[model samples]
Target chain A: MSRHATAEQLSSYVDGELVGPRLRLVETHLVECQDCRRRLDGLQRVVAGLHRLEPLAPPPVLGQDLARRVRLEPKPRDLLERLEEHLRSTPLQSTVGFTFALVFALAVILYLFSGWVERQVLLHQPVLVAPSEVGAGAAVRRVGPRSFHAEDGRWLEVGVDPRGAAVVAVDDGVVRQLLVFEPELEPLLDEGVPVVLAMEDPAGGPGRVLEILPTPPEP
Target chain B: MEAAESTAAALAQSDLDLVERHRYGDPAAFEEVYRRYGEMVYSLCHRLSGDPDLAADLTQEAFLRIFRHVGKFRGGSSLKTWVYRVALNHCRSRLARRRLFWRSLAEPDEPGPEAVDPGRSPEDRAIAHDEGRRLTRALAAVPVAYREAVVLFDLQGLSYEEIARVLGVRLGTVRSRLARGRERLRQILEEGEPLAPESSP
Candidate 1:
C-alpha cells in the first residue's frame, strides 16, 4: 500500500479492468499518494484526449474499388483449398473432415477415370450391325463388333483391311461374296452409321459402289 | 444501451449468415460486410499507418483477405473482432515490411486531413484541431504494440475483452499494454517530445 501504483494498475483502474487485491491496493495508494494521484490524473486525461480524436472517414473510392475487386475475384478452385475451407467451417472434427474430403476427392477421381476408360474402349472397338438373317434388302442393325446378320440366316462381316480398304463380306449356305468400297468411303464407315450398298457385281469385286445410302431403305 | 445490445445481438446472428452467403457466392455478401465495417477498418488503418493513401490501400487489401478467407470464419468470434484482427494483422505486416512501423509522425506543423470540422466556430475549432493534431503525433510516437491497444480501446471504443480478442492476446496483456501505451502517450504529450524513443526490441 505504501508503494506507488504502477502505470498498468492506474491504466486498468481507469478502465475498470483491474480487480481483486490489486485494484483495492491501487485505490488505497492513490488516496495517500499525491504524485500517484497526479500521474493517474495525467493518464486519464491522455485517454480522454485520444477519445476526442474522432474516427476518420476513409476515402470514398476505397469501398467502390474493393467491392469491384471482391466481385471480380474468382471463387476458390483448388479442390484442396475448398476442402480446407470446408474443414474450417464444418462442425465435424478436423480428422473426420479431412477423411471425408480425401474420400470425396478419391471417389471423384475414380469416377472420372472409369468414364475415360469406357470412352477409350468404345472409341477403339469396331461398331457392329445386328440384323436378323433374312435377305440383302433387310434392314441391317449392328449386332456385334465388325459383323452384321441378315434375316435370311446370312452373315455379313464388315471391316477395314490392313491395306486401308473398306470390305464387306456376305455369306449364305454355300456362296460368299466380298464387296470392297473405295478408300474414300473408309472414313465415313468409321462414323458408325448404317450404310446401304449397291454392288456392281452380285458375286463380289473391289472398288464397287453403284449406290450408297446412309440410312436403311424404308420398308 | 438497450438499442446497442439489440444491435449487437442482430449483428451476431447475421455474422455467420453473411459468411455462409459469401461462401455460396452471394455477390452482395461482400458488399454488405464492406458497408458495415469499411469506415471502421479505414479508421484503424489510418490511425495506425498515419497515411491516408496507405490506409486506403491497406483497407482494400484487408477486406480482400477477409473475403477470400471468409469461409474459414466459423463463428468462433464476432465478425467485427475477426475483421479487426485481420485488418490489424495486415496493417502490421505491411508496415513492418516497409519499415514504416515506428516511423515518426508527420511534421508537427502540418495540418492533418482531419484538422477541420465545419460544424465548429473558427477560434474554438482551431484550438481543438491543434490539440487533436498534437495528440495524434504523440500517439504516432508510441511503439506499434502499445499504440494499437490505445487506439482500439480509447479511439475505437472497443471493450477490453474485444480488444483482447482482436489482438489475440490475453486480458492481462491488454491491461499492461493500455497502461503502458497511455503512460508513453502522456509523457510524449507533456514533455513535447517529437518522438518517443523506440525501446530496443
Candidate 2:
C-alpha cells in the first residue's frame, strides 16, 4: 500500500473522476511526495505511450461489405408487407383488373368485328326469318340481337342477331358456348375474330367492356 | 439545469436534432455526426481492440450501426457516451465471438496496433511507434477488467461516471478497476526502469 494515496485513487485523480476536495487532496499529496510523483509520472508515461497507438484500418472487405449492406438492405419492411404480399397471389390480384380489362376489350372488338363481318357476309344474303319461327309469347327485352356473355361473369353484351350471329373470328370457347345457345350460328361462332364486347352487369350499373376475342364465321 | 447551460445536457439535444434530421430523411446530418465522432470512435475502438484492422472495422461498424439504428437512439446518455457504448459493446462482441478471451489475466499482444501514418518519415515516427507498442503490450498484459477501465479513463479520457454508465457498473467498481489497471500498467512500464510506488503513509 502507498502512503500518500491508493493506486486507484491516484488513477481517478489523474482522470479527473475524483471529486473536489478528494481530487485536491490527491493533487496536494502528490506534490509533496517524490514517490507518488514518480508513480504519477509513470502512469502518465504509460498513457502517453498508449496515445501512440496507431489506428488500424479494418479489413478492406469489411468496409465494402458494410457499405454494400447499407445500400442494399436500406429499407426495413413496414407492418403491412405480409398482407400486401398475400393480396398479390389472390384471385383479387391487381392483374385481375388488367385481365378484366383485356376481356372487356376483346369483347368490344368482337362486337365491332361481328358487325363488320355481318355487313361483309350478310351483304350477299338476305335477313331470312326462319320458316319455323320461335315466336316470343309476350314480354321481351328489346336489346340488340348480336349479344354475348362472359364465362367469368354473368355480364351480357346485348343487341345482335342470334340466328346468324357472327362472333369474334376465336373459334374456341366462344363457338362452343354459342353452339349450346344457338346451333344455327354455331358455324359463324367457330371462326374466331379477336373483338371486344359491352359488359352488362345485370345486378348493377351501365354496361362496361368485357374482353377481346375472334369468333367463327356463320355458314 | 434551469440556470446552468451545460454542454453535456445540450449534447443529447444535438444528437436528437442530428438524429432527427438523419432519421427523418436527411443524410447530411448523419454525416455531420459521423464527422464529429469519427476520430474519437476510432481511438476508442483502436484502444479496446489491439488490432488496427479490427479497430477500423469496429470504428466503421460503430458509425454504420449508429447510421442503421440512429433512429432508435433514445435521448438517454449524451451522444458521446451513447456512441462510446455502442463502439465498446460492438468490440466486446467481436472479441467474444473470436473467443480471443482474456486468459485469466490478459495476454501480452504479440503484435500491436497498425500504423497508418505512412506519410511520416521513419525517424519522426519511430519513437511514437515504439511507445505505442510498449503500451499495447502492457495493456494486453493487463487483466481485461482493468484494461478497459484504464483505456476508458486514461487514454480516451471518459469520466468515471461515464465509464460506469458505459460499462454498466457501479462508480466504485469503475474506480477500483481503473486503479488496479493503472497499478498493473505502472508496474509493467517501470519494470527496472527507475520507477516504483511510494511507501504509504
Candidate 3:
C-alpha cells in the first residue's frame, strides 16, 4: 500500500481475493494513483483477451474415440508391475518399490531354500533296510524283537509266520519275500530271530537275507 | 408418467453418481461421463498443447487414465476438477517431453498455425482467425507453469483454489504464478514475439 500496489496485489485485487481493510485501502490508493490504475487496466485487458479467445470444440469423434481408447487401455497383469505402477503414481513411489522388491526377493529366496531343505533332510537322515536283504558281509545289530539295526543306520522290522515265509515292513510299506528259511531257521524266527534283510529297492521289493543275528536283550 | 419422470431424473445423474455407477460395472455410466467431459478436456489439451493431433492423443490418454484409475478416486475433489487435473497432467508431461526433444534439436518451441476447419463460415473465420492466432502465440510464449495457471484461471475459469488443487501447489503459489503469468503474457502481446524461455521462480 505504500509504494503503489505491487503487480501481485493488483492481480489479487482483480481476482477479488483481497478483502477487508486491505481491499478498501487498495481501492483508496487506486483512486489517487494513475500508474497503479494503468497497471491494473493492462492486467485486466490481458485477462479479458484470454477469456475472449474462442473455446475450441473438440472433433465430433473425440468422445467415441476417447471411449474406445479408454476401453482398449490394457489392464496390468503382473502383480509386481501393477504394484510398481501404483507406487509410481503415489507420493511414496520411491520407498514402496524398494520394499516390494525386497519382499519379492525374499519370497524367491525362501522358495529356493525349501527345496534345499528337503535334500538336506534326505542327506542327514538314516536309510531303512530289510533284514532279509542284507548280505553276509553287511554289519548288523539286533536291537529289538524281530528288528535289526544295520551299519547304514536303517531300522528294519521283519516278521515270519509259522509257514516259514517272512514279510518285511520299512518306511510305511510292506515288502513280501518268499523266505526259504531252513526248517531250523523258521523256529528261530518264531522265537524272534533278529536278521538283517537287504532290499534291491527300499521303497518296496523282494529282499535277500544277509545274516541272522542273535536278538539283543531289551534294556 | 411419474415413473417416466423418475427414470429421466435418474438418467440425468451427477458426475459422482455416474462414476459410482461405472465403478459398479455400468458401461452407460462411463459413456455418459465420456460424453460430458470429452469436449472440455480435448479443448483444454488443444489450447495447452497448441496442436490438434497432439491434443486428441492427450485427450484419449487422459480418458484412458481416468477409466483405469476411477476406482482409486477418493471423493476429496469434485469429479470435474479431478478430470481436469488428469487431462492437464497428461498435457504437462507431453509438453515437457516435446520441449526437451525440440531443445535437443536446437528448435524454438513456437506452436504451429491453428488447424483450419473447412466447416466454418468465411466471415467467422476472418473475424477470429488473427485474434486466435495471436492469443495462441502469447500463450505459447509463457513458461509452462505460469501458462498453466493463466490458462486454467482465465480461459478455463477455474477458481484459484481449484487451480491449486489441480497443480498440487499452495494457494499463495497459485496467486504468484497467475500474476507473473499475466504479466509475461502482456509483455509477449506488446512485443509481438515470445520472450526467451526462462525458469519460473
Candidate 4:
C-alpha cells in the first residue's frame, strides 16, 4: 500500500481480482493518492473505449461462402480426424514424431548389433568333428606322412601308422586328440574318457596306449 | 450462479447434440451452428486481425474447420470456447506465417475510408467513425499477447473465465494480461505512437 500499489495490484484491483485485505488496501490508497487515482481513471477510460468499439458484422457473403466451402470440403473421419487435427495443431505432433524416430533408431541399432555379434561368432567359431570320422574320412588332409590337419584347425598328430585314424574333441577351449587303433577304444572316447599316447620305438612299430584318464564332468 | 451453470451446461449439451446430428448427415445442423456463432466468429477474427476482408476469409475457414471436425467435439468445454480456440489458433498460425499480424497501424499510409452506420445521425456517424478508427489503430499498436486478452475481454464481451478458457491460460493470467493490455492501450492512445513492447512477467 505504501508503494502506491504495484501495477499488478492496481490492475487486479481494476478487474476486481483483489479481495479482502488487498482490496481494502487499494481502496484506502486510491482515496488519498491523486496520482494513483488519475492512473486508475486512465485505465478505466481505455476499457470504456474498447467497449464502445462496435462489433463488426460479418461480410454479407460469409455464410454463403462458408456453406460453399463446407460443401466442397471433405468430411473428416470422426475420432481419427480429431486426433490428427489435435496432433497437427498441438506440440503433441513433434512428440509423437520424436518417439517414432527414437523407436526406429533403437530398432536399427539392435539389428546392427545382433548382426555384428553373429559375424564375430562366425569368425572365431571352431567346428567339432568326431575323431573316428576325421581320421578315416576325406575331411582330413595329410600335412605329412604321420600328421594331418582337420579343415577346422584341429590337428591330428599321428605318431605311428595305425589301422584306424586319429580323432579329436575340443570343448570350452580344451582340446583332446586321440589316436585310436582298436575299435574297443572308440567306446571309451564316446564315454568321455581321456587317454595318452605312447611313442613307438626308434624302428617302425605300432604306437602303444599308455594310460587312460577319466573325463571331467562338464561345468 | 447455479442457474447460469445450468444454462451453460444445457448449451453445451445442445452443442453436442448438434455435432452428433451433423455426423449423422443432418444438413441443417451445421448451418444452425454457423447461424449461432457466425457473427461472434467474424467479430473475433476481425478484431484480432484488424481487417474485415481477412476476417471474412478466416470466418469461412473457421466454420469449414468446424464443419469437417464437428464430430470430434465432445463438449468437454463450451461450444463457444472451442470455436474461439479454433478460430484464434487458425488466425495465429496464418498471421504468424505471413509475419503481418503484429504490425502497428499507428501510422496509416492512407486514411481509412469512412464506415457507414445507418443507425446514427450524420454528426454521430462521423464522430463514431473517427473514434472507431483511432481505437482500432491504438488497439493494433498493443502487443499480441495483451491485445488478445483486451480484445476478447473488452471488445468481444467474454467473461474473464471464458477468456482464460479460450486462451488456455490460468484465470490469474487473464486478469494480469487484461490490466497490462489496458494500460498499454491507454498509453498508445494518449501518445499517438507505438510503444516499445514490454516483456510479460
Candidate 5:
C-alpha cells in the first residue's frame, strides 16, 4: 500500500476494518509516519472528549413543551376536504391531473409490491428494521398515497389527496400509530429512553417502524 | 426538584391525551402545543441560530408550519423528529435568506448568562465553561453543512445512522462528513487556524 493512504482507508483503519495485508501495511505506515499517527491519536482524544461534553438538560419544562406542540399541530382534514371538493367539481383535470394520477399509480404499485416483499423478508430475515426508512424518501416505501392513510386520516382519495376515503383504524384507535405524535415522547426520550415510533400493524397492513428516538427516562 | 419531577410525571398523561384530542380537531389543542414546545423550540433555535431573538421568531414560524402540516405527519417518525425536522428546515431556510455573515456568527457572542454562584468564583468556572463555548464557536466557524454535521453528530450525540437520516445522506457519506467535520472543528478550536476550504456539496 502507498504511504499516502486515502482518508477513507485511514477511516477504515480507525474503525479497525483494515485487515491482514492491509492491516500490516497500515500498521507499518503508522509506525513510520508521524503525521498519520498523530491524526489518529488526535481523533481518538477528540472523540473521547466529545463523549464528556456535559449532556445538556433540556430546560426542565421541555417535555410539557413538546407535548404542547404535538397537541397544537393542525390537522389537514380540511385540505383533503377541499381537494375532494375540487376533484368532484372539476370531474376531470388536464395534464397536471393526469400526470399526478400517473405518478400516483406507479407509487401505489411500487408501494404494494415492496410492502409485500418487505413483509415476507421480515418474516424470514432477523434484521431489526428501524424507522429511519419511513422518512427516507429514496428508500423503497411500502405504501402508496392511495392505500396509505396520510396525516389527514383519510384512507383513500383521488389525485394524491387524502379525502373521500374511509378511515382505517390505526392501532386500536391510534391513527398513524407509527408516528410518535405524543408530546411527552420527545423530552422523555431525550432524557435517554430509546423511543420506538411504531405503527400498529393496522391489521391487514405492515408493521412499520416510523422513527426511533432515544431519550433516557428520568430515573 | 422533587416537585418538578412529580409535576413532569403527572403532566405526561394529560399531555399525551391532549395531543391526541388536538389531532382529532380540538381547537384548544393548539394552545397546549404552543405552551409545551414553545420554550424548547425557542432554546434549540437560540443555540443553533446563536440568536435568542431570532430563535423566538423562528420558533413561532416553526410552530405555525408544524400546525399546518401536522395532519400530513404519518406515524412513521417521532413527533420529536417531525417537529425537529420542521425547526431544522426553518433554520435552514432562514440561513439561506440571511446574510452569509450572520449565518456564521455562531450563537450571539454576548457573554452567556452570569453564573449564579456566590462563594465559589463564577469567573473561574465560567472560564472553564468558556472552553466548551470555544468548541461551539469553532463549530460555528465552519460552513453550515459542516456545522450541522458536527452539531448533530458530536454535540447532539446522534448515532451515525440517525445523523444520516437527519442529514438525508448515505451511511458512508455520514462517516466521511463527520470525519471531515470533526477534523475541521479540531483544527479551528485547537490550532487557532481557519478551516481549510472544503469542496463538499
Candidate 6:
C-alpha cells in the first residue's frame, strides 16, 4: 500500500482476482501511480483484443461425420431396444418367423437325404451279414485266403481279390450267398470262432467291422 | 413461441441432467451440450495454439474425448471447468510433443482471413481487426505456460481457482503466470517487433 503496486498485484487487480484488503490496497495505489495505471491499461487492452478475435468456424461436415461415426458404433443398449421395436411390428415379425420356418424345412430335407445317401453307400460297398442272420446255427470253414464256405450253403470271398479283405460264406439248406467286407475285419476273422461280420460304419471312411460272438463251449 | 420456450427450458437444465441424458442415449442432449460449449472451446484452442488448423483439430479431439468419457465425469466440478481442463490438457500434451519442432519453424507475418461485420462502420472494423492481429501476434510470442494462464484468465474469463483446476497448478502459480504473461505481452507490443507468423506442426 505504501510503495507502487507490483506488476502481479496490478495484473490481479485488472482481473478482479484480488479480494478484501489486498484489493483495496491495489485500488488505493492505482489512484496515485500513473506508471502502474498505464501498465494496467495495456494489460486490459490485451485482454480486450483477445476477446474480440473471432473464432474460426468449424467445417460443415464435422457434425454429419461425427453423427455417422457414432451411429456406426455398436451400441449394446440401443441394439436390444431396436430389436424389440422391430419385433413389435407385425409384418417384420411375420417375415422373421417365416425365415425360421424355411430354415427348419431345409434341415429336414437334408436329414432325409442323408439316409438315402447311406443306403446307396451300403449297396455299393460289401454287405456283411451277421452269422446269425444267415441261419440260426451254421458251421463255417475257410476255403482260401479270401474265401469261406458255411454249412448253410452260402459262399463268401473278398469282393476284390485283396489279401487283407474279409469273406464270410454261408451255405444254409435253403440258399447260398457270398458276403465281402472291408480290410478292417481281417483281425477278427479267426477259424472256428463264431464270429459275426458287423456292417457298422468306420469312423474314417466307408467300411465295416467284424465282431466275435461269445459262444459257450460244448460240455 | 412454444418452441422458443422449450429451448429456453432445455438450456436451463443443469449440466448434470444434460450429461445424464446423454448417458441414457439421448443424442439431442449431447448435441445441445456441444452447441453450448463448442465455440468457447474452439476459441481457447485457437488462442493457446497460434495455428488455426491445429486449433480446429484440437477442438474436435477435445469434444470426442468428452463424449467418450462422459460416464467418468463425476459432479465434483462444474461441467465448464471440467471441459476447460480437458481442452487445456490436450493442448499441453500437443505442445509438449512439438515444442522443439514448432520453435524451429519460422513463418512470414500475415494476418489470417478476418470476417468483416457489415453492420460495423469501416473505421471501427479496421481498428478492431488491427488490434486483434496485434494481440494474436503478441500472445504467440509469450511462453506457452504464461500464455495459457493469461488467455484463460483474461480472455476466457475463468476465475483464478478455475484456472488452477484447469492447469492443475497452485493458485499462486496461476497468479504468477498471469502476471508474467501480461507483462510479456505488454513488452512485446511496446517493442513493435512484428509477431512471427504461426506455423502448424
DockQ of each: 0.38, 0.26, 0.22, 0.20, 0.07, 0.17
lDDT of 6 by residue, B18-56 (tens): 877876788887687678787778778777776666666
Candidate 2 chain A: worst-modelled 10 consecutive residues by lDDT:
A125-134
- Decoy 4 TM-score against native: 0.61
Instruction: Report the alpha-carbon TM-score of model 2 versus the true structure.
Output: 0.57
Docking class of 4: incorrect
Query: Which regions in candidate 3 have their CA more than 4 angstroms from the true location?
Result: A74-219, B1-13, B100-125, B193-201
> Please, what are the lDDT tens digits per residue for candidate 1 over residues B1-201?
999999988878899999888878787887899899998998898888877778889999999999888778998889999999999999999999998754456554333256346667777566556667888778888988999999998888898899999998998899889889999988887787332122201
RMSD to the true structure for each prediction, in A, is: 11.0, 14.3, 16.8, 21.7, 26.8, 18.2
When 1 and 3 are scored with DockQ, the better candidate is 1
Q: What would the per-residue lDDT of candidate 5 be over residues A1-219, giving only the tens digit for each residue?
A: 565655555656755767999889888888888888777665554544444334333343444554466566445465568577677887554688798987999999999999998676433321122233323332322332213322323232223322221223343334442332245455666676665443434223766554445633469
Name the better of 2 and 4 by TM-score: 4
TM-score of the second chain, each candidate in turn, equals 0.85, 0.80, 0.76, 0.86, 0.69, 0.80
Interface root-mean-square deviation, each candidate: 5.6, 4.8, 6.8, 5.9, 7.5, 5.3
- Give the TM-score of each candidate: 0.65, 0.57, 0.56, 0.61, 0.49, 0.56
Candidate with best TM-score: 1
TM-score of structure candidate 6: 0.56
Residue-wise C-alpha lDDT for candidate 3, range A187-211, written one tens digit per residue: 6766777655443344344534445
Proportion of true contacts reproduced by candidate 3: 0.45
Tens digits of per-residue lDDT for model 4, B104-135: 57553322223355676777665555667777
Question: Evaluated with DockQ, which candidate comes out highest?
Answer: 1
Expressed as tens digits, the lDDT of each residue in A72-188 for candidate 4 is: 776645566656777788764458778898699999999999999866643322223334444454454432133334543444334533334334353332345433334556678
Q: Candidate 6 residues A1-219, lDDT tens each?
A: 677777788777766778999898888888888988877777666655665665545555656656666566544245566467666764544587789986998899999999888766544344233455335545443322223334333323334333344444433321134445445543444334455543432112344444544334469
Compose the digit string of candidate 2's lDDT tens values, residues A115-217.
Answer: 8996664232211121112132212232233323332222223444334432322222121232222344334445653334443322233544434344434
Model 5 misplaced regions, further than 4 Å:
A4-29, A48-219, B1-20, B26-44, B100-108, B111-128, B193-201
Candidate 4: where are CA atoms >4 Å away?
Answer: A76-219, B102-120, B193-201
Q: Write the per-residue lDDT of candidate 5 for residues B1-201, one digit (tens) a residue.
A: 999988756665555565566567777776666665565456456557765456556776787787776655654544555566687788888866785324444344542332244444656455435554555566567766766766676656566776776667898887777777767765665576322222211
Worst 10 residues of 4 chain A by lDDT: A199-208
